[model samples]
Target: MDDKKPLKRHEALKPLSRQHHFGLLFSWKLRKGFAGNISVNRLKAYADWFFVHEIEPHFKLEEDHIFPILGVRDALIVRALKEHRRIERLFHDQDNPKNSLSLLEEELEAHIRFEERVLFAEIQKVATQQELKKIEEIHFEIGSKEEYMDTFWEKN
Candidate 1:
């Protein structure tokens, strides 16, 4: 059993946390695609769309606005930056779609878990109210959900 208490996310970070939910869902879709024997090209296509529509913007927002709460020298931010680059490379890698997508699926999920459980907790603890207010403004930039109709992950 898990021993840790749940971390209460500050309102300023809620938008990113919400985005993390979508990220988790993205990983789930990948798992479904693999299990259903969906085509690598088809899975990669969805990953491409999600990378543009979700991951790219999310990473920028975190890098620009959120992660700065703890500053660049912090170990958590360093790890997060490394993870972001790894995930970005996975998304960009097209030569081996199956291997790349599988790695993407696992790495992305683990990265989200780390942010939610550790990095954000540290940020929330250290950020000043003024800093959080600046971070809170970022909610306006969170893009609305654009429907992707492929539904390859859904049961037929």
Candidate 2:
């Protein structure tokens, strides 16, 4: 039997975790688009949509609600915020979109992985019950449902 401890995600952060799942799906869809020789413009357009609909709000929630739990100076929070800026840049880079999309696919996946595996675990470990409750409140109020029109990731 493996003895490694399974990380327990708290109820407060569940919404963010679910968002991370969508982020991973976004990355996977981009990979599929790349593999299938889907047009870079199509992929970039979808990326832009996802950035506005999903990533921007998600980042705001984390920065405003969650990161303060760990403090801005905390190395993990600093790294996460930097990753957010980089990911945003990748999504917005229209001049060299093909390369940018490729980098976005990789970097976005890595950013999600970092949050899921490291930063969030630390946040949950240190956050007070009151803080967690507040996080849950804001998260629910934000309503994280995504409804993008194009299901470009679907196998044609």
Candidate 3:
């Protein structure tokens, strides 16, 4: 049974949370693709596109603007950075993309969940009003996602 009270995400974090929603959707699409028997090459192409466009920029945004609230030495930040590197490696593994994408699907979703539920909660607890405002200002481009033309996820 689940009894956790939902954290009311700070305004500064809402944009990232929106992006996390898409990240979860991305994972669901991967599962759909696998179930639909979509070709690994096709899935890898989409994963490559997403990693280049969304994941890279997203990671940079957190590392630059958000994670600093908790400092680089914080255990949560350390774990997040390690996850980021591991996810980057998973995204770039071309020789064994089938296994890699499968891992990526799981890894990315889990990473987003950890940030949303744990790290962000901790940050919000400690972040100053000015710090939150700074974060919001830096990452305030809501509803401006660049959509990929390939609809392999939909096909699957």
**Top candidate, metric TM-score:** 1
Q: What is candidate 1's CA lDDT for residue 153?
A: 91
Task: Please identify which of the two predictions, 1 or 2, would achieve the higher lDDT against the true structure.
Answer: 1
Q: Write the per-residue lDDT of candidate 2 for residues 61-111, one digit (tens) a residue.
A: 999889999999999999999999999999889789999999999999999
Q: Write the per-residue lDDT of candidate 3 for residues 47-72, one digit (tens) a residue.
A: 88888777888888888888888999
TM-score of every candidate relative to the true structure:
0.94, 0.91, 0.92
Deviation in Å, model 1, residue 143 alpha carbon: 3.4
Name the top lDDT candidate.
1
Candidate with more favorable, higher TM-score: 2 or 3: 3
- What ranking emerges by TM-score with the best candidate at the front? 1, 3, 2
Give Cα-based local distance difference scores for all models. Answer: 0.91, 0.88, 0.88
Tens-digit per-residue lDDT, 11-37, candidate 1 = 988888989999999999999999999
Output the lDDT of residue 65, model 1: 88
Candidate 1 worst ten-residue window by lDDT: 136-145
Clashing pairs in 1: none
